[model samples]
Target: MKKLVVMGGGIGGVASAYELKQAVGSDHEIILVSDNPWFEFTPSNPWVAVNWRKPDAIRVDLDEAMSRRGIRFIHDPVVRVRPADDQLDLSSGTVLDYDMLVIATGPRLAFDEIEGLGPEGFTSSVCKTDHAAATAQVVEKLCEAPGPVVIGAAQGASCYGPAYEYAFILETELRRRKVRDRVPMTFVTPEPYIGHFGLDGVGDTKGLMESELRERHIKWLTNHRIDRVESGVMHVTGVKPDGSDAESSTLEFAHSMILPAFTGIDAVMGIDGLSNPRGFIPVDEFQRNPTYANVYAVGVCVAIPPVGKTPLPVGVPKTGFMIESMVTAAVGNIALALAGEEPRHRATWNALCLADFGDRGVAFLAVPQIPPRNTNWSSSGKWVHLAKVAIEKYYLHKVRKGTTEPFYEKFGMKLMGAGKLRGQA
Candidate 1:
């Protein structure tokens, strides 16, 4: 029997491994490697930062959990991936060979790209459990002493949902603490406008998000490039529509959480033919790296081109629903490979997102993620917030059970005629 190694333990990686186990069954041995022993529910990170959800409650121990499913778990950081020899080097000084590899080590926070950014710098983050916990501390101090707040994404950054979520969630928390009036919040983003969400305004998202921000009494600046962040201040360069310099400004903040750019992990970077210059692995429609047929990728580590040209750099988003579709396609292809047949599965890469606004939220569905979708819809209400909580709990339950596709969820998706891959027949 051959062996399959899946890297990273986030939603994309864990879900892929679980689905692979269910698909291949006893045909192959599966191993999962990650830098952390726990799997984080990244969607709930915004809630965690505001103490709405506790860290331990959202974290699942990969060692105990994967072991229950008969999958080996390695909690060491990857030193390097020598795709040339089908070998993986780990920080623990061990090498492993795999018949197939799925690189899902999500985006490495490119904090160093900008001086004095990220957790160790001027602003805060919700990228990881520890980061959320640290930001929670910042939130508490901010509650005691309210002041101006700045939150948004940096140029070249792809994930914008979390930044928007942090802004609204933090606003909700401060109001709960009876300090909303004193704290002035401003959103800073590289997108030409609000609600671009890296996919070029899906289904009136631009209008909806802009209205939401206005209703919340939050100010916004678009086409903004973060030059640098220095203690309680951020230097940003505003770019015009024609990609020319609009102006430069320095914004002051009592508390801030600026999302930084993302890059591929060091282990997967600088590998010719395997990844793009930005360190993201380039995969075909089937999610397989062209150079290494046995290698596949999903989630933030996968390379996708920008939607269109913009004054500031803006990349596409790999939402959870889209990543699940990729994971499903990968599972089908791997199953085909185990049978010595050619792989034939391609991911649809659609976008179904839920943006919770503390007590209320917004939800959108873009069948193809890009604009002009056959299915493009958006709605908002308190029920969306409830749905977000429900999804968080459901996802955690499935993770603990090592189940990727429950029959009920799949049936529901089918009834709605959604969540199927592009080439599904």
Candidate 2:
């Protein structure tokens, strides 16, 4: 039996393993290696920080889930990836060889890039379950001594949805606690506009998000570069499009949560000719590593060039739907290879985001991913909240049951339209 090794047990990695199993059948051996034994649903992390959801609600046992699906699970961190020799060195001093490899290790949070940032410092983040728990404690304390609150993403940050979600959630929570007046909240982002979201700007997202922030009485600083964050102040620089100095605008906050930029995971980055300088793996349109046919990458681990530069750092966005498409294509190609037939590349991915606005939510769908594109659609409503909840539960169920249903087929069925369905069929 051929050995297929999947690095990382996150959403992308587990999804890929399930798809690989379906594509290659029971004859092939599949192994999933990761630092943690549980998979956390990242989208629910923002809610967890605000005490809306428990940690157990978003986390799942990876060993049990994968085991039922006939996939081997190894709970250990990978130290190095020798792509050329098809060997992976684990931190436990064990080496595993593979006939094929899938790098879905996800992004590494480079909090050290900014001095005095991260959990050790002035602010807290909701990016991880533990971090969110810590942030919850800090937020509870801040509620009593409410002053100024700053929430946003740092330079080169791509996943902007969570930042926006957290900010709005905090705003809503403050209002519910009848302490909205005591807290002065501000949003600081690397995006050129309030809703650029790393795709230049989605349909009506700029206007809609700006209006929402205004209605919520939330102030914002866009196109601003954060020089450093120390104590309770964040130093910023840049212009507000009218050519005015946005620099030296120090905003003091009692509590803050800034989403730092993301880079490729260390293990995947350590592989020579397998990753870009930024540590992101460069994959072909088929999601296969360009240099290594048997090697594939998906999700945040794949390298995508920036749409443009802002005063702060900017990065390309990779939503759940886009990652799903890449995983599907990778599985299709791998299946063909296993069947001794030529692999065909036919999957095209798009971005679909549902941004929660405390009480309501805004939904945006973009085709081709890059800006200046076609078939771009967007809408907003309170019903999105219900939809978001339903989907979250659906996802949890699917993960626990180890279902390999295409994510788009389940969540994005309406957005896919007849053209995509006919083509895939």
Candidate that scores best on TM-score: 1
Q: What does candidate 1's lDDT look like per residue over 338-381, in tens digits?
A: 78899889888878788999999887777778876777777678
Stretches > 4 Å off in candidate 1: 406-425
Steric clash pairs (candidate 2): 156-313
lDDT, candidates in the order shown: 0.88, 0.83
After the best TM-score superposition of candidate 2, give how far the Cα of residue 30 lies from its true spot, in angstroms.
0.8
lDDT by residue for model 2 (175-289), tens = 9988889999899887888889998887788988898889899999887766788999888776666545665678898989999899987887756679988799998877888
TM-score of 1: 0.96
**How many clashes (backbone atoms < 3 Å, residues ≥3 apart in a chain or on different chains) does model 1 have?**
0
| Model 2 root mean square deviation, Cα atoms | 3.0
